[model samples]
Target chain A: MKDRISALVFIALGIFFLIGALRMPRTTEYGKYGAPGIVPAFFSIMVVLLCFIMLVRKQRSNSESSSTPAEVKRAENRRLLLASAMFLAYVFLLGKINFIVLTSVFLSVTSMVFLRKRFILTVTISVAVTVGIYYLFSRVFLLPLP
Target chain B: MYTVKVFFESIASTLSNPVLLFHLSWSTLLGILVGILPGLTATLGVAILTTLTFGFPPEIAIPMLLCVYIGAIYGGSRTAIVLNIPGTPANAATTVDGFPLARSGMAGFALNVATIMSGIGSIVGAIFIVSLAPALGALALKFGSWEFAILAIFGTIIAGSLTAPKDPLKGWIAGFLGLMIAMIGLDEIVSFPRYTFGNIQLYGGISLLPVLVGVYGVPEILTSLKRVTKAEVVLDFSKSERKLSYLETIKKNALNLLRSGIIGVFIGVIPGVGEDVAAWVAYDAAKRMSKEPEKFGKGSIEGLTAAETANNACVGGAIIPVLTLAVPGSAPAAVLLAAMWIHGIKAGPLLPIQHPEMIGYVAGSFVIATILMVVFGLLVTRLFLKILLVPTEILMPIIFVLCVVGTYVLNGRLFDVWVMLLFGLLGYFMRINDFPAAPFVLGFILGPMADTNIRRALMLKNGDISPFFTRPISLVLIIAITLVVLSKYLPKKRGEKR
Candidate 1:
């Protein structure tokens, strides 16, 4: 399933690039630098050729290697969903709450959520590092960090 | 006598610059933070900051970039030990051993070891640039398009051969794909249009930024999304005590420092490879050479030391070729080249007369940045580990938003936001397929270098293309490139036999 999907994507992308290349503006430079189309045209062709190679090369695992690729079973769906939620909130909050505040809030919330830390310790460490980073960059480094 | 004047003048100027001092210290801290953050990358930090530093003087600007470069490389191991995610791809090897050590509850010990090695790596890499660069700078006197073509090929081949963990052939295949892609833009010497589709944006060529982000940043996001919270361990700092002295550790592992440093400098001087490859090669060598190879990838202090040290050393190495030939040794250095160009300082072959002071300035700035990285990296390791304690639920979304917003900030255009989303989706998918993204980034970064140089080589002989074989440097590079390709096909042969 995975291999098939990858092959399809590569073929599709190859098409996009090939079309993009052909449509590229015809550029000519003076004094023998040559026309610009040659480079892009070459790249597009290589892309298409490689995509074909990739699709062809998708054989079963090369068993001679000492290590074979393995896919691990994912954890519970709720855990995955919750992790996604936490990350989403962290991002939205960063811009609105101010980068420093958001970062601190994030650090604390994430620590407690992931490590299952106590509240006070979580809050303290998160606030401290965020403040410290802010001070170091904004004040010490005098950077106009956003 | 003239050399002494150049060195002192550069040193004196750097010392007196307040902005340089501030940015040096500040960026080190930021580098650590981004390095510690799983989704945030060192390359991203430098590339993004490239916009902000567009106006700073070249001396200050280059130094600022170095701070992030050093800091980010070291900062990556923080998560490598504490969370095992390896904040940056370069530190992926560190996680092989580092996470095991952290799992053994030696998080502090592992971090401390990483820092000390980082300090050693930076110092040695810097010393290399300071001493050997002037000599090598003179070698550029003999180089031409022939030499440049060979050097870029050498870099592409070595980068591929070294990065793949298990299969050398897979590495070369990816590299060839990159070389082919790099060949897409307009041929440099003759100005013959090669691949530019209809878009003018492409006429400037595929920006390294987009390709790098697509090849690395996106795939990382995709593959990681499913595993974002698995097997995570947040360090309980209160449980761990101060483990080792930085100075003492340095004294014992001086050889690792020197080895990794040499590796870093060599990697850096190459035209297109970067710190990540240097770090891995050094780490692999250190492990193979270690008395107990078994100790590696299990929180072996030496493993963490080798990886961190070598990557940091690459900073100094990346500058050598940039100073002499105007070709950046790595991705960030390529951006550094653009910044230099923006500032009206041409960096390539004519640098001897074009900007005589550049070598000293770049050399001096890197040394200062390395000093700051050590001083700051030591103090911050313990504190950063606590960040690992965050729950995945809360961390991922926040990173998501930053990814979106940061992308938006790039051109203040929604197009970039769309690009970010599209690439993020692509990155996520690539991860699932087991295609390594770093090789792709290496390809994208080196593409223009190969494209322009080969064209120049072809144009020099009016497209005969045969001189590519006759030239010694080009011949060696072609052989290396061939060897890289052949290494991959060997597996197919084995399979056929089976």
Candidate 2:
């Protein structure tokens, strides 16, 4: 099922790129072969062909029987979804908030989610990491933070 | 003689600089720590360091990256020996003989043997780089656009095929997708936009650094969060015997060390095939050639030595193609190549002519890094054990922050951060679905080269495409690509027949 989904995603991406490439100027001052879109067109075509092959192969294999227990899968999915949501929120809120405060909050929340117990330890470590990174980049490396 | 002279001169030059040596010690130590962590890989180590060191001078930055590269590959063996978990993919084979040796109370001996073997392997690989890179670069000067275009295709195709042997098609799809992604910005030849959607940020195209961090870093953080397994140190290093008995074992297996080192370098020279594959191949070969084959996986020193040596040697091997062709020999080398570009150093056929000292400098850095790796490997065995005890839940959040900082610092753009996040999710999806990321990266690196050259080859020939097949080097590369694709399928077809 995962393979099939991936195959469909890839195929869609390939077709999208192929259409985009086709719409671009196909001839340049250099010649027909020097078209700016030629390479992209070729790559998109290859992607579509290869993904079709993969889709076919996945269908034929019929080996989607997962050995992972349902409970374990559910737990894994929950962790994944939670972590992903936190990451998305962190990126979205990055520049809007102060680097230190935002990062500390983000890290503290993630640590709490994953570490579960030990709230004090998680929050402390999160603040420490945020400050440590802040100092290391700004003071030591002289690199700017977002 | 010229290579030898330059090698020593470069080493002498670097040693004379106290600041460079200081950088080397810290970076190499940091690399070892990165390697000892289970989910963090050498590629991620190099990628993060590449971003952090973006402002440093090329001389300082490049060597630091090399130290991290060499040290990370060697460091992974520690967790392999102690915890039966390969800290990095490169050390997977080491666990077979390594953990069993630990189980048999020879963990200290195995660790010592692996350190010595890693040092030897790196030295051998560096020697090859000093000798072979110049020759290969000279030969590359003969290659025209036709050859380069075909070579780009060949590298991506072969990388995809080998990196994901179980499903080469998925690898190919990933590689092509990378190539297509490389087309997103304005067309290089003309100013016509390709896929930017009229956004000013997209005009610059997606930066490689953010993509790299996203693809390698984010997935590691997410996947590590999902894994619940915890590892404990099998034995304390100080309590185990730290005698010179392992040196005697190494001395007896000198032939195995040399063979494995050669195997590692050869594997490294192949674009996109990294240390993990080299270690496995060397281990398998050593087992076949072993006097006591049954001793393998049952605490054989020879097996441990073979795996460690090849993987380290592969580091040097992987750099060969990077220096000569600008096509990375491994995933980490790909990052190293990008770091070089970021530093305004152009690698490939013109490298020898443009930066003649670079080949020697790299070889010297590899040698120095190997010595430091060995020294630190022996000196800090206990420290690594403590590091191994750090809970992943705490460690990963810090790493993810570093990843974000690393990505954002590259261009100071929030858009790049979004790119990193998207790619990270894509990378995780690809990982779960069994698609390899190495070929995608290789394709991205080679995309411009392939795009510009194929068109240039056509223009030079007045729209004729025949030369891509007819040219000598192009023909060889074409045949190689065809063989790589067929090798993946023909065997399966034969199996089905059976």
Candidate 3:
């Protein structure tokens, strides 16, 4: 099922690239083969073919049983989704908030969520990591942080 | 002989610098710490360090990265021996005999053997790089645009084929996807936008650092979170046999060390096939040649030694192609190539002529790093066990923050952060689907070279593709690429044909 979706995505991407290649300038000084679109067009065709091959191969393979129990699998999927959401939020808030403040909050909250029961240790470690990174980057490496 | 002189000079200079030695020790230590962790890999370590070392000069920074590479490869064996989990994919073969040895109260002995073998293997690989890489680089100087284009295609195709030996189709898809993504910015030839969709940020094209950080970093973070947390593996050091000496271990596996070292260097020189494959190959070869073949999985010292040696040796082997042809020999080497570009030096045919000292410096740094790995490996065994206790819950968040900092350091654009996020998701999905990310990276690195060279070759030939087939080097590359693709479907023979 996942393979099907991936194949469709690649096919769409290939069509999109083909359209983009068509819009690219064709009349370069060295003629059609030297045009900027040639490589992209070639890549697009290859992608479509490869994705098709993947689709065919996946179908031919024996059906694989899910290794995890349904409930455990669902829990893992939810955790992955939530973590990705948190990361997205962190990126969005990075520039607006102070670097150390935002990072500490992200770190402590993530630790709290993942560790769940270990509050004090998570808080202490979060603060320490934030400060240590700030010092290492800004003072030691001389890199300016966001 | 000239190479030998330059090599010694580099070693003397590097040893004289107290600051350089200090940095080398520190980075290699950090490399081992991360390598002992489950999700942290050599590629991730080098990528993060690449961002951190932005302020350092090329000489100090490059050595530091090499040290980390060596340390990480060796460090992975520690986890494989102690915890029965291979920290890095390259350590997978080690876990076969390593865990059994650990269970039998020979964990310390196993580690010592691994460290010594790793150092020996690295030294062999380093010798190959110093003696052979320059000659390869000189040979590459004969290549023209047509040859370069063929070489680039061959790299992408071979990487895709080898990354997932069982499923080359997915690898090809991932590789082409990377090439397609690389085409998003303005075309280098005509200075025309290819697929920007009118977004100004896309005009300059996506940066490699952010994509690397995101693809590798974000997925690592997410996967660590999903794992069922376990307390760190506790060691039983109370046994009297735990004090086994390194000299005894070395004496027992002398022949295995030499054989595995040769196998590792050869595997490392091959494009796409990395330490993981090298270790397995060496292990299998050792088993077949062993006086007691049945003892392999039952904790033979020879098995553990062969596995550890080949993987660590791969680090030096992998650098050969990167320095000579600008093509990476492994996934981590691809990042190393990118890091080289991030620094002022471009690696390729002109590398020897343009930066003659680079080979010597790299050879020198690798020697120091490998020796340091052995010294530090023996010294820091107990110390790393405690570090391994740190819960992934706390460790991963910190790593993710480093990822953000790394991506942000390159070009200082929020747009790059978005690129990282997108690629991170892509990497995550790819990982879930068993699609290889290494080839994607390989494709992205080589796409421009292939595009530019193919166009140049065509223009020079007035749109005739004949030169790509007629030229000696291009024809050889073409034939090699065909053989690689064909070999994928060919059946394996049971016995040695000869």
Candidate 4:
């Protein structure tokens, strides 16, 4: 069932790529062979074919193993989602709040909430790590970081 | 006589410079440090350090980069053995037997064996590079557009199929997905902007560094964060039991060492293939040939040695194609090629002609780097074992920040960071579905070559695809690709009692 859904997603993506390739402007000099869309079109076709095979394989397996493995708990799923959300937010808000400040907050809050750690230890470690990384990149390695 | 003179000259040049020696030694240790940690890969180490070494002279810069590249590849085994979490993808095979050995209170012994085998493998590969690079470069010169196109296809197919031992369909899909992603920017052939919906940032195409870091690093952060409370490392083994009979073991496993090293070098010489493939292939072969095959994967010393030797040897094998043909055998080698370019040294068939001393210098640098790897690997085993005790909660957040900084520092673009995040999510999903990410990486690395070559080949034939089938090398590649794909589907005739 999961494989079928994944295959459907791939098929959709492949079609999208095929459409994009077809819509691309063709150069006159290289004719049909050297068109910029050639490889993309080929790739799209290949992906769709492979996804179909995956769907077939998934179907064949369904008859053999009716039993399914345990699914992730709702709470665990929620945690993963929240972690992803926090990460995206960190990237989005990197420059606005400054590097060290934003990272410290993200780390402290993440460890405290998900890890169920002591707030004081989390905060201290978060601050120390953020500042240490900042010094290493900016001062020691001389790399510019946002 | 000529080889002897060139060899001595290379050694003299490398040893004469105090600065070069320092760079080689220091960068190697730093690289091993980076590789010991989870989330950081050898490719990332080299890419980030390329920026730092940009101001140095080519002589110092190139050696530093090579040392880091070699060191990181060797260092990944440490974490694989001690923690069971491979520090790099190449060490994945090592973890099969290495972690089992560690669990059985043989961590120190395993480290010693890994260190010795890695050095031996590296030296063998280095010898091949110094002797065969020019000849291989000449062979590469014979390749035309059709041959290159076929070679690219072969690489993608083999990499996809090999990366996923259980199911290759997912690997192929991931590889194709990567190729599709590579087509999103401007078309190299026509110079027309592709798939870019008027975004200025999309015009330059996606950077490889950010994609690599995001795909590998982000998934690690997500997974490690979820498992906050993991088992701590146990370092209670006795000093006497930890002592390894290195010379005796090497003598006993001499044939295994030779065979695995050769296999590793062979895999490394193939463009777009990497050390992980080499390690797995060598491991499988070793298990098949072992007198006690039952011991395989259950703390088999032979299995661990085969994996470590091949993966380290692959570093040299990878560099061979990069310097000779301007084609990287692995992801890290691709970055090394870029570093060479940055230092105004053009690689490929013309490299030896333009810079006569380059092959010699590279050979010399690799030898020095491998010796340093052995030295450091032995010296730091106990030290690195302590790092396994650090809680993931603290370590992961720091690594996540480093990933962000590493991506952002490449071109100082916020857009790259966004790309990293996007790929990170995609990579996590891919991993959950058991789709191999390495094939995707290989596809991205080889995409341009595949794209441009196919178009060029077509143009040469005036839209006729016959040459792709008719050319000798192209035909061989097509057959090889067919065999690889069909081998998966071919039913075994085991039950048919004839």
Instruction: Give the Å shift of residue B431 in candidate 4.
Output: 1.0
Off by over 4 Å in 2: A58-65, B238-244
- Candidates 2 and 4 compared: the better one by lDDT is 2
- Per-candidate total of colliding backbone pairs: 55, 0, 0, 0
What is candidate 3's DockQ? 0.73
Which candidate has the highest DockQ of all? 2
Tens-digit lDDT track of model 2 for B8-33: 99789888889999999999998998
What's model 4's lDDT at A16?
94
Q: Write the per-residue lDDT of candidate 3 for residues B410-469, one digit (tens) a residue.
A: 677778888889999989989888788877887887788888998888888788899888
Candidate 4 lDDT, tens digit per residue, B1-498? Answer: 344356567677777778777888889987887777766788878877786776778878887888888788778888888888787888999999998898888878887898899899999888888888877877777788888777776777777887786787887888888877888788788877888899989988888878887887888788777652365454656745556678988998898999999999989987667899999999999999999899988999999989988998888898998887777888888788878887899998788778877887788878888878889888875686676666676677777877888788768889999999999988898887778887787777667878999999888878898988888878988999999888866643243333
How is the predicted docking of candidate 3 categorized under the CAPRI scheme?
medium
Query: Candidate 3 at B336: error in angstroms?
Result: 2.1
Question: Which candidate should be chosen as best, given TM-score against the real structure?
Answer: 2
- Score residue B201 of candidate 4 by CA lDDT: 96
* Better candidate by lDDT, 1 or 2: 2
Ranking 2 against 4 by DockQ, winner: 2
Candidate ordering by TM-score (highest first): 2, 3, 4, 1
Compared with the true structure, model 4 gives a TM-score of 0.92
- The DockQ-derived docking category for candidate 4 is medium
Lowest summed lDDT window (length 10), candidate 1 chain B: B405-414
Candidate 1 residue runs with Cα over 4 Å from true position: A1-8, A15-33, A62-146, B1-9, B100-106, B141-143, B146-154, B165-206, B222-225, B237-248, B400-412, B488-498
Which candidate has the highest lDDT of all? 2
